[model samples]
Target: MLLAHPALLADRVREYETLSALDADEGGAAARRRMDDIAYSLCVATGTADVDAAVVAARHRLPGARVHDDSLITAMHRLRR
Candidate 1:
């Protein structure tokens, strides 16, 4: 499987989070569409079906990610060693 570059994943994650935090009255349809797009992108990048899982996966793949962190990806990486 081809993994997404950490920098790109980080940017997507930040964009998703920022859009998610917007007020319902803010940004209108454009923001919603962008959020959906980001969610889909993140899912594809992480090879996961769920956005929450995708976010975790992206974070785990980021540079300086703690090997000892308790995330599922961290455990998986450990098992692969």
Candidate 2:
């Protein structure tokens, strides 16, 4: 599995969060389309099936992720092993 570059992942995560915070009417169709694109990219980058999960995974993969921060996915993955 190819990992996405940390910088690219960070950018996508920021873009997704920013778009998500907008009011539906404020963002409109263009923002919706862009959000969808960013969500897809994030899912692909993090190898996750859901946008929420993808976002969490992307954050954990970011450069400054705290070593002590054990997210759900990380915990689940650990249990699987």
Candidate 3:
């Protein structure tokens, strides 16, 4: 959705990351996952071709992501001013 229509969800990923970072690990496996998410978001924000690579990196980090599916879904619907 982000890469396909970045305008629709500009900075949303950053919002998600910021909120997630409040409790996200500093430098653990989970942190790496969040970093992947950050990278992905940044790519989306910049309309960069690197979004694909970011997704792949995020996928590789999924096992250690430790993020619950419900949380992700909730994040998708959430928006910060």
- State candidate 1's TM-score: 0.76
| lDDT of each candidate versus the true structure | 0.88, 0.90, 0.53
Q: Which is the winner by lDDT between candidate 1 and candidate 2?
A: 2
Best candidate, lDDT = 2
Candidate 3 whole-model C-alpha lDDT, 0 to 1: 0.53
TM-scores, in order shown? Answer: 0.76, 0.76, 0.29
Displacement of the residue 51 alpha carbon in candidate 3, Å? 8.3
Query: Candidate 2: what lDDT?
Result: 0.90
Error of 1 at 12 (Å): 0.4
In candidate 3, the residue pairs with backbone N, CA or C atoms under 3 Å apart (3 or more residues apart, or in different chains) clash, namely none
Q: Clashing pairs in model 1?
A: none
Counting clashing residue pairs in each candidate, in order, gives 0, 0, 0
Query: Candidate 1 — what's its lDDT?
Result: 0.88
Report the alpha-carbon TM-score of model 3 versus the true structure. Answer: 0.29
Q: Compared with the true structure, what per-residue lDDT tens digits does model 1 show for residues 1-81?
A: 999999999999998887777752267887777888999999999999999999989998999897576788878999999
* Runs off by more than 4 Å, candidate 1: 23-27, 70-81
For residue 31, model 1's alpha carbon misses the true position, in angstroms, by 0.9
Candidate 2 residue lDDT tens string, 48-79: 99999999999989987975776888989999
